[model samples]
Target: MSNNKMSRPADALVEVADEHLDKVLHSMAGETAVAHDDQRTAVHALVAKRARVLVVQATGWGKSAVYWATTSAIRSLGGGPTLVVSPLLSLMRDQVKAAELAGLRSATINSANVGDWDTVMQNMESGDIDVLLVSPERLANPKFAQRIVPIIEHAGLIVIDEAHCISDWGFDFRPDYQRLSHILTASGATPVLATTATANKRVTADVAKQLGDSTLVLRGSLARSSLRLSVVPGLGPLERYAWVDEALGRIDGSGIIYVPTVADTERLSGFLASRGHRVVAYSGRLEAGERERVEDELRANQVKAVIATSALGMGYDKPDLSFCIHVGSPDSPVAYYQQVGRAGRAIERADAILLPAETDEDLWKFFATASIPDVDNIDTVLQTLKESGEPMSVPALEGITGIRRGRLESLLKIVAVEGAVERRDDGWRSTGTPYVYDEQKWAAIRTARAAEAELMRAYASGRGCLMEYLQRALDDSEPGPCGRCSVCTQELPLGGFDVSTESVNAAQVYLRGADVIIEPRKLWPKGVEDGRSGKIVGAGPGRALTYADSPGWRDVARVMSGPDLPLDAEIFDGVVSVLSRWRRQWQRPVAVVPMPSRRHRLMITDLATRIAKIGKLAIIDALEVTGPAPTDDAASLVKVQALVAGLHLKPGVTLPTDGPVLLVDDTYRSGWTMTIAAAILREAGVPAVLPLVVHQLP
Candidate 1:
């Protein structure tokens, strides 16, 4: 049956071998016409020419076609061989199937076929396989490298799918990707073609860096015009199910709902099924048959929706999906966009909704706990791997009890000691075990952990358009309000704080009181700013400012509502009330004075406690730290200094010096430590010192 049929060529989105181009098109005749845009064809032609390229396509933009078609064309041209490095098994399977359907020979090499390695290798050596699909781990095989040398010499194309995985901005990262450029260079520097559906410019650059030079970039637009975005607030896990019910009840056509955890998927799926809605659960733990059945149902339109995690639509090509909902916030915007992108694949109007849960705070907390693994953590994990002497998968490490994916990944490098773990064709393995924690490396990890935590917290707490937050997080450049977040919507009232007109300058100066000259407006206030006080404005453009700075920093006043605690307080009724009542507010935590001022310090502590019980605010301590607090009113600022100090120094250690400080004396005729401490703190570059004298000083 050696028949070679030429079919009609599709437009730009796909360009097959002149011999098989028509066949590829004919094969896809009823499967929705492949997009025929110029960018698609040009990118394809470039790949066929063996030119290194970076193609950025939007959601549902058909980036896969570019790779598949070009590879088929190369096979026809007798380009020795080609390899497609994909991030997921699903994509590899689909690609293999598509190539076979188009009548081209393609074979996938992954752990699933580890038992039949000889068979796959024979096929590769004999040239029976035109295209080899592999995971990054495959690069570790010495034999694979030997096999690819000839192919590289013949000028083969290496396609890195899900290219964003190489970038820090990507939700999923593979350490093997960091070694990709070197791997290719080892094979004689073959041309590279990287593809991703979602990535900002910063991420795009990282992708290229992993591929080496001689790169051609093909970027698409960010606008998903065919999709509509929306959000629902004030919903927890179970309550959110109700909102999902209401939303799905109104819409028709296939859709997907993404949950943060597997437990959530089960609960939501069960709830929907119980309510007589056709739903299925998709998670990594699902059996192969069950996954196939669900996909079949989706293709048959037998199911209305599927409540799943990121595993649902890896290689799914259903075109008529109408909605995509996120039950919880994704840690990063790149991830959110990719997850929701599974919807509206058919060029129809689709909706994407994000339902934020109270517990959604978990994502940020998790991020704070394990944002970026420092060299030390990475070494620790790698050292453990070295001791195991067995290759492992990322998912396997992620499944560890008590350890989060973020922490596990962050620790990999520290353990690996910079590429100590070689990327195996099947999995990752550490080169050797370590005897102890490298103190230098551990210190580096600590420093990085703190910096990353602050960054994540800022992302979560910054008052602005949600879109602005997303954009800024993805790109470090200054971004304006996105005008599309819940905070940006006019219907939602000011959240998370109280509003006031006090200038940050005045409040800061007043709090510092003659210690610092620069009087910035106070950002936290108990009520809205008035004409007589400061004005309210957004800190950055395109961002909302729940509490903006106004004039006469002194004119605006913020009433305290709660006690000054050292940690973030839990959300409660009173906290919510104060947050809702005042658009903005500030909290001044009265610091302790070491001198004899017991009664006054107690009163100040009481005042602080009362304010904390009433509103949303930040601490503005008015005292200098000389020694331990005389009363609770003056607690230790030792930890605070440790936190604010430069990372070059050891943690928990404080430097002694004479700096400007505010002294809090009980109805004092004279201020001592508060003043001296203020001087010391000021000399240490502290902006201002605010003195809270329990009784009026006369």
Candidate 2:
């Protein structure tokens, strides 16, 4: 297709679209002179008829251009400002900039801009803004919802970016996105456009159904001609790290390394940096400003790669990102496609490599279950609110129902959607609306997820052409072998990267030194006794090697803690190395103490004695287990209660009056055991307690 033909607007809309296309090109610094015909069609569909449309196009296909141009065309027609329901802050930031470049003033209302909400609203009311971007979570905000109603009634267009999030079948389904259905109903005749790059047939149908009847669905080819897909499966953690270190030098340009967890991002980033790669870690945990800084660095090629979680997955605008390497397989092929789509956007032949690990399934299960709401917990929350007959704050609910604050908040949102509960200024109150548990629906979702997981496994194992397998998994119409992937051509350029023996050994050494920081629990959990529920005073920072970190200390720690397995010299040496590195940040302890464990007392004692010997400190038996340990899956309150009842000071053993103590344990989970132990020692006159654990559980 010629640029002239692609740029030519449809009849009757040619002049207006040409003007808007020029504005978009200007905003993009004249990167291209023509907009795709699909882009022009989407724009005209919105401006000419105020129609609802779904555009499922490949990444870098100018989906953003369609919306920005549509906003421009609508404003020229004296239409109200457009509203964009984006899924992430990163996406919103990019959209706001694009809107400005397209000659449309845009402002965002999200958690990061609480102070600027008033200013944004004022701009909207004064006709100073042409587009308003918001996160799905903002729709649930009572204040924002009330304030946005007037705007919604007159909105020129509503764009749901990453529209796959609205489908339960999507890998990244979010309940908050479901709130859009209500907004659509209230939006009346306002034009709506849903855009996404990764959606299977099921997700496409679901999203279209949500947008109402007669929604124009425009889906383009899912194939990315610029992407070269391959899989390097069965690599352990250390090997993967070494492989990345070696591969980074051979890759074409700056790129991203996607990990399955936050800890993996930090650990892998550190390992790569140690191997002389300029890299940084990016996760949801980072502050907004810090995330933006890292994004800018990647865009400018200041860093070779940013080891990131899915938090960096959507709408990160680095047009020339040359490669995307996954340390572990994503839960579904659709998600993997979406992430790999970030690369090869504006370049020819970007590498997309997947290094699947044995532990990927475990991570997938953890994440899948974490998002599904617990029926019992939801019912308990609703019943409590109903009994109260008034609004109650989250903290108060925590006290009444023993649910952790985070889980409680999630449950509240679920119930609020069901109309069983409502949020007010004070807190949350029940609406007396009876709610039925949707067991069948949840079961179907679980079944579908299991199938997706199997499909991911098949993809990693080279059951067929990599691209074709993914396309079929997404139910794309034109599924076929690309003839460029490793499987189809029997050539693997990604796996051809060489790793020296020295690099592999260095990676192993780095993995062995699995030191991790154990953050102290500052506030005691609610529903506990007042004496136990206040601020924990003498707790200090703690350290550990790894948290179930596979193919590393996790294996060693498991063997050492198992029945009849003794601590070895090599494991002990690694512990010493971790402590040596941690000592620089920690105050030198005056003494060392051990927390008694029912299953691993001997291992804990050995570790403590070894650490004390190395540090030249006294080994004190400060606390002993009074009863059995709590179950691994026990709730936070249950764990605390069991620890409080089971742990006690050793007979005739008094802690020092004014110096820090090294409190050692075999492993750390909920930290209740360490918390209670530290409290006991502190009450006995110890000034500060620092926790050291061999392994930490995620």
lDDT (0 to 1) per candidate: 0.53, 0.82
How many steric overlaps are in each model, in order? 72, 3
Q: Clashing residue pairs, candidate 2?
A: 514-545, 516-544, 547-696
Candidate 1 similarity to native, TM-score: 0.57
Q: What lDDT tens digits, residue by residue, belong to model 1 across residues 59-177? A: 66766666656666666645556677776666777778777776667887776677776777678778788778887766545577667566555545677788877665455655556
Off by over 4 Å in 2: 1-37, 404-406, 550-554, 584-587, 613-616, 627-629, 633-635
Task: Estimate TM-scores for all models.
Answer: 0.57, 0.93
Which 10 consecutive positions of candidate 1 have the poorest summed lDDT?
Answer: 539-548
Which ten contiguous residues of candidate 2 have the minimum total lDDT?
1-10
Stretches of candidate 1 off by over 4 Å are: 1-49, 111-118, 137-155, 185-189, 368-371, 377-410, 413-417, 423-698
